[model samples]
Target chain A: MAEDTNSKEYWRWTESNWRDPDIDWKAGEIISVGIDVGSVSSQAVILVDGKLYAYSNMRTGSDSPKSAENAMDWALEGTGMTQDDIHYVVGTGYGRVNVPFAKRAITEIACHARGANFMYGPTIKTVLDMGGQDCKAIRVDQKGKVVAFLMNDKCAAGTGRGMEVFANLLGIHITEVGEMSLRVEEEPPMVSSTCVVFAKSEASGLLREGWPKEKVLAAYCLAMAHRVVDLLERLGVEEDFAITGGIGKNVGVVSRIEKELGIKALKPTLDTQIAGALGGALFARALEQKGRKSK
Target chain B: MKANYGYKDGSGEFFITLDTDRCTACGDCVEACPYGVLEVVDDPVDPLSDVQVAVVTEAERKKIKYTCGPCKPVVDRPPLPCMTACPEDVIAHSW
Candidate 1:
């Protein structure tokens, strides 16, 4: 019984990886991969003949195919690439069928609308995601497919494991909970319980009435951006919009869900938790370009 | 105002709850839902109280734990045809 290592896991979160040093994956002729595995993190990506050559983002441990092969061996670590030079993999979220080196699995709502149409483009047409035990909202279309969606994974009150259990109950450091919930001094009203166990006992009863853990992380990121704007108002927020998971690196719940849906979500120069493993490596490069145009 | 609906991932809690003031848009739990997963609508939580209720079906509200897993029978379990066709008990599943 010896494993305390000075216990400081304030909801961990900080495993990373990247690659693209002007691309060269053995003169790529397709490569493609995309793991995902999500039930609280695990990405992978890698693309090549379709661009973004590497990625990682770790954490989903209790073994989902060894967290999708440790997020594809940390996105092919030194980049001398392996997994047999990958030609097509795919496997999407919620442990996408336990990704045992998937060749196809898909559905993380059509891989977060084709990974928010390749990381916020294709005019986005709304996405949202916010994963780690669920919260979807999709809509897509202009090629990213899924024209309608709205998930919630029932409870953990607005996902990302309810803001990593409210940043390990305010010991704080899940990447400083969005700038310490925007160093609050005024916003405090929400947290009326959307139910992450009753908004974490109403944020420890407002820190026992004295408040301040940045005002209970600004009333629990304004009740998780008003419960993800009531699940993106049941699929009706169209214009552009994009948000992809890992709570879109929480700018206190994406600036209060862009001030309650006045839009403005589309900003991601890559790594908004690798939009479902970059839409499962762009659906494993469109299923290896439809098996080389049906050979 | 017990709305609930479904979702509680990593395999557990598949809510359904209704009791929206004893829901009475009574489509008999949308005809004892055999996976159409109930319907009726309108009461987006008291939209100025016009009252239409029943709910759950926004595409089976995120796959109600696999569309209410075929009447949830594991042994003798027998109360679900949408909570025995809810007559004001206002449905309830929470499995």
Candidate 2:
């Protein structure tokens, strides 16, 4: 059988990295690194004396340890730094335990809360992390410790993976799905099914009924937004909420979630997806400081 | 307190809700589960509470959708073994 050469992976998102030119890592008293190995993606965050320095976001490969190493290597690409220079390492996300160099592994729930606190400031009390395989609603205290939390990982109805499947089904780029969903003429009724398999069939039926691609996207996004809202309500929303993870980049779902919750998520100055890894790095920094004090 | 173990993924919800208040740390559910998904553990929800409660094992929590799939049939689904073994009616499966 001849293999099709024209097939494209529409679900794949662009991976990238960034570093701060101003920061001198050698002068920093403590160099901490955080690696978040999620089911669909991996991110590495480097902090110098508790300040953001460099980071990388990449797709997670089948091997989680290799994915962590890839993300870390990319973050250090132009920094003139090596793994040995990192004083402490914290691993987070679903594959936290797989980070070979990490000094400690922390739950994504705690890490997301801390990361949201740092990125959005101390005022953020609620953190919604919609990751590849799971969605978590966390309530954080002033110090970013989890006060209450709820997680939904069994279903992919409102998660990033669900969005990716939709994008692939629509033969559109994953990044463009959010924008395209918003381009519809008016709001469409949400798809009834919360299960992704059923939702996909429903979407196909809508397309067969002559609904435009944008309208179908709108309906799917609305359904996702409502599903996420139900999860959030279970944990009870608080003031100054923030969103993290890949789905945070999807404006279609975010906007609908904001409308349904009647509260705006804080504008992020840093990449929202890095929240978990950043939080892990922050924890590493704290642990390093504590160790120094003990000595 | 009611603790829900297992996840709701794209396919369906496969949570086993355990009511801790009425649970007497009975090992019946653990014995009844064919997949070894249930276990008796210290009350994780309340540290002060001295009672042990039934919970889905840590390794099985993420994959309960599959571990518990055998008990769930498409038509004429029968009562789950774990739920049936719980004398206090403390276990419920949400499928």
Candidate 3:
């Protein structure tokens, strides 16, 4: 690939597949990008010498490559790092292969497992990634290799997007749904509407039925968590389970998940959302190590 | 209310499109943008998707598709239906 010599713009399209930015690039330090391109949103994580640098959560735009580029551009803006500094690039998620500039591509399942182990530790066996578009339950050995996995990619009923609707109907923030759910005394009315559109109707009906907001909200959280449970069961969840993806940030959901499965789900400080990116960054580190070993 | 994108003219993945013009400025779009990309605005064609009108100038206008992963199915086609069907309406598919 030709080096973009004129790297003097906030962002400039160097080619259809590449862009140049104004940040100075440094070598020797490993820099990589992990991109999780899902049906709902695309994410980019940038790392420098195996340290967290910057991350971007962007809509997957029209194309995975374009979305990856947009996410990469956003991460660069946050980290003040440039493409030239990146020694290795690993892309994950469904669209990892679509990343035009990625040196290698790995499955998001692997990336998530690798990322979780890196942050939490190698002992994590069961992994649950509640992504924007889907929910996945993966059982892996200590090495972060997939041993068993089940995913609800075909449906979006219980993913991060699902909670957003519950938040809107109750006139509460999405972030609050988990906390509020934890507060409910009753199990609240279970939302039977598996369909998102119909769920809104159901939630509105509950409001008309005069159910307490907390109960109704709690039901929603429990209902969504059930989906994860189902996936985990299918994958045969184990102890020291780790959760990832954007929804992992929701304490309400996480706690409910623990209750439903009768097991605690551990989340790293960065938690589920950045699992794929962290996996990408770790891969960058591994690649650099391999290069040195080879030389 | 919902718009979906087809195989991007250049890039390969199907893109989701949002008719910011048709946006009701209702919080639905705001709630729908899970990545927190869309914000309610007092003005259309401009003012309010990224930042509140007060900070509209500082707001980004580059389609900001980065905010919410749009579901633009096709120009006027029923999107993946899952996005439209999901209660969050996070996915916007023009049917």
Every model's DockQ, to 2 decimals? 0.09, 0.22, 0.02
Q: What is the lDDT of candidate 2?
A: 0.86
Rank order (by DockQ, best first): 2, 1, 3
iRMSD (Å), candidate 2: 5.2
Tens digit of lDDT per residue, candidate 2, span A165-207? 8988899888888899999888999999888899999999999
Q: Best by DockQ, which number?
A: 2
User: On lDDT, who's better, 1 or 3?
Assistant: 1
| Full candidate order by lDDT, most accurate first | 2, 1, 3
The DockQ of predicted model 1 stands at 0.09
TM-score attained by model 2: 0.82
Model 1 chain A poorest ten-residue lDDT run: A1-10
Chain A TM-score for predicted structure 1: 0.39
**Cα deviation of A24 in candidate 2 (Å)?**
1.2
- For TM-score, candidate 1 versus 3, the one ahead is 3
Q: Please list, in the order the candidates appear, how each scores on TM-score for chain B only.
A: 0.31, 0.91, 0.32
Best by lDDT: 2
Clashing pairs in 1: A153-B7, A153-B8, A154-B7
